[model samples]
Target: MAARDPGASVPVRAAVARQAVEWLVELQSGEAGDATRAAVQQWRAAHPEHERAWQHIAAVNARWRGAAVPSPLAHAVLLDTPAVPARPLPRRAAAKTVAALLCAGGGAWLAHQATPWREWRADARTGTGQRRTIVLADGSQVSLNSGSAVDVRFSAGERRLRLVSGDILVSTARDRAARPFIVATAEGELRPLGTRFAVRQHAGSSRVDVFEGAVAIRPRDAGQAPPRVLQAGQQARFSAAAVADTRPADGDSVAWADGMLVASGMRLADFLAELGRHRHGRLGCDAAVADLRVSGSYPLADTGRILDTLRATLPVEIHFITRYWVSVRPARR
Candidate 1:
């Protein structure tokens, strides 16, 4: 771990905050090694806030590290396997079912790793940098993006998910006609009465953006709570201490699942701040030039080229402190 630059000013800390997002992005793409641990240690030592940021990231991963790699919905779809009945499944049979779904390992061992056997049949998920789509036995499709996790449990009452982290886009397939689909996050739960929607969990809160159809949100800890319903072209942000916040839904917000970043006349700083989530190194801007605005569709697959394009079009500079560390500042002023 490296020591913090004692003389570093506030701007430097801001730059690091931006860099930290990128580090998190990279860490998700692969396993964090010794170098990563050292970097985290150094970031933690830099300032108290850095430690908080790192802990938030670490906490998200810790939640899923040992959890079972869920079997994809594809099993029930492509394979034409019937839904595991809602009734209590025998332990040995359930293990086989889970193992069959993951295909990488056996279910018995994984079942042992999950906590609270009751929640065992509950929904299971993967974490950041992971993408998976499952077709439920009933034909619904679920596609999850990186840094996201979820647990699923379907019964006569509802199709539920405990969203651990990240995001998911779901298009319900015809299931038993009327069983509602619900997704729960720290902030609240989204129950889609209609067919398609996306749910994302972040910073102890959750956001629901519906592209088509309607969904209802209920905070997990609330008793007899009246859930707020959202229809197409609408979005909602929910948290523990706050009532659900609803607003117009932006079509572009869900573009990341397709590996695209659609920025609509966004500030250069803000765009970079978002881009930092997909790149591996630091991304900073000259404080003087940070306010410049940018608009376009950038491919998340080539973040380096995205930076290069920024340099060509804007009056800004890109600095690479290391292959994994980059900083954007004023054009070498």
Candidate 2:
């Protein structure tokens, strides 16, 4: 099998590493289905890198086995007991303990890889803590917020984008072909009229904020009412049934494209929730401090640094249960 180039992009290398770890964990689980076995076989056959990665994992496992302890009691002790009372483990038992550690590590990696894997493979996407801009074939520009994904399709009559998840800011160019520019989300469709706008998709609704010109929002099932036209500085949210009342758009709405999260007297919980969109895993605050007001502009690129700034500026303490699990609480005097 040919080895993968060491200089491959970080995301590609990380994805392959996760796949290798997942395969190792599944095979060790002893309950891998026939389908799982077939999938792994297909994966190895599809790419030489897959076989190379599997070989590396196998070599690591062999090394662990060679240094393992002999006694089962020693394995249990090493796994469950504290290190202060160090005890020499038989070689066979130590091997089993190493294998168990490897399995646990693989399980943890799988948990971390679950959420953003789809976005990682999207046609156009931004990873957690990443923001990017893409220029379409027709000269239109789309800026993706962190953890966002969008699929673009240009046909003879229309320029369409499907918002699979997260948020995007679109600046429509004058289409020489005169194809209408449209963005579709689960909730509805947004048609831009020579406009610059932002669209965000939530669990049950989609929001459109027009920065310039106008956008026509049509609910997915507009039974009675006609499409709503939102002019510059207006924003509205809609579900499948109806469009909400238009509200004044805030400058903060498009600040994310500039890598800044701008907040003005926003609740601590709401601010954290928005910030979490650019991050991975769970990031919340204790209910006790949920109502506290926050006002600032923070860089979205480094969430850890943003958290550090919050801890320094606010009367809150940051608690990290794990790198993936974090919370903020009222600081103790």
Candidate 3:
């Protein structure tokens, strides 16, 4: 697509590592028009990492381009879902094509795009930037946030919902079986008291906010320790070991169910982390502005507009190397 990086010093990350391969696939397919070429030129100048990643992919792809299949790289990445060919890419060529992306420290992020059995096999799952609502057999409604998944199980004694990944909002339905409704995460289980609440599964802990009624937090490691009961208007996070102290619940916890993110005196880094969940790829805030306070009610569907909002109101600049790679830095003074 574009020439080598020449010489640029920047870590390849965000979508640069992934987008580079897609651009190469387009060029190698001999279908890229003049417009596509011009866009590639502009993308190369977007940031140093973009150039570096583009060059690296082209360089490595050259090594595997002459395999048994004539168009191995073209069909391998399936960049943003390119046109399907009459024939599928062979396993040998496909592996090498994916290997092209599994380079540098960014392999983890792109690798996530591959098969994630847990999320894929989940009974209910939402893709990046998407949400879903499913009605259970007992009429209970569960709402899944972006990049979320859940598995529903019912038994004679309990109505159980497992949070495989991401967050969920539960609206319990009175069951004819009269079973207690419970939600489980990696760290603990939540038993709702005929009320509506939101549960978020984090890396090391699980957070629950009681918007309507009380709930009990039972940590997996809480041997003789009784479950912590959280009343309405309270929130708590718990690990397998113990539950943290309760705090005043934020009404904004359920706002995502309505497609909005509400921030009130929230740190910029925290704000971006929440917003990033509704988006694909990376949305990072520089440490320099990490603690800056932000307050607003932003729509989840228009993440780009939210970034534009920060640029207009805060002392910040938004750098967009690609649609999938964006960063927020202090405004250049």
Candidate 4:
């Protein structure tokens, strides 16, 4: 072959690199079996560049599995591949360059592993005093407060999360055709009809609060009863029975995400209960002080400062049983 035009080979390499990346994704999902392997083999047999690309991907996989290959060396392998030819080569001889071609595509595959979508999602849990917000590929926003766990799944037909523990605030964005978003817990499945809501899972039950638009609640199995539609500002609890007995969500109820705990004339005990969920330890109030009125918005991010503020305002004493345990008792008159 006459001298190949260097620029003519660019698109060929680019196309091969793209195809290799897709293959890498498929392989990571555990779906590339015999037939897929055969297809890859055929591609490799057709071109040396294809074989190079596959080899690069294999090297990256080996590194991810704790092989001794370093990232710098892997990158070098990809960058060192020969330039593409101006004309397509004879198919059989192309296998010579497969390893070099794979190197060109492996970088992206390695980076994908660092992303949440590529990682094995679900079984994700947060420890006390920890919060995480994740953006799903489908454009959904999920904000998990302290001590929470939820499994996320998105398919072409549905977006779902099974809340195994703790709380999650989901703001579902409008899909191309406005698909429904559903969050399921032990209590039931809360389907947001293209709206934003928060699901809080407790020991024996779970709560759903709709902040925007409408949502529907149904049992997990969907055999017992029909789903109930909940409008904005409506809240419900799923326990022994689906209870619509809900109060208005004040500023305090939704302020914790912003580090504020808004308590609007709530009981001392109830306020403490709410605060305890956002902290790393336990908080309690003595029986005598349990009924004391709590009417201020405290900082959820800094529980210690909030407790100090409470001490200065209320006629109570803060007791520290341990770093993780605390209680309050009414001050003597």
The candidate, 3 or 4, that scores higher on TM-score is 3
Which sequence of candidate numbers ranks them by TM-score, best first? 3, 2, 1, 4
Instruction: For candidate 4, report its TM-score.
Output: 0.60
Cα lDDT tens digits for candidate 3, 31-53 = 54555555566667777777766
lDDT of 2 by residue, 20-122 (tens): 5444434334344455555556555657766655544444344344444333322222231222213444333333344453443343333433323334345
Per-model TM-score versus the true fold: 0.63, 0.65, 0.70, 0.60
Per-residue lDDT for 96-137 in model 1, tens only? 433333233322322332322222233544332335687776
Which regions of candidate 3 deviate over 4 angstroms?
A: 1-116
Candidate 1, residue 58: how far the Cα is off, in Å: 14
Question: What lDDT score goes with residue 218 in model 3?
Answer: 95
Off by over 4 Å in 4: 1-123, 177-179, 221-224
RMSD of 1: 13.2
Give the clash count for model 2: 13
**What C-alpha lDDT values do all the predictions have?**
0.60, 0.71, 0.73, 0.62
Model 3 pairs whose backbones collide: none
lDDT of 4 at 125: 53
List candidate 2 segments past 4 Å from native: 1-121
Q: C-alpha displacement of 25 in model 1, angstroms?
A: 13
Worst 10 residues of 2 by lDDT: 76-85
Count of backbone clashes for each model? 13, 13, 0, 18
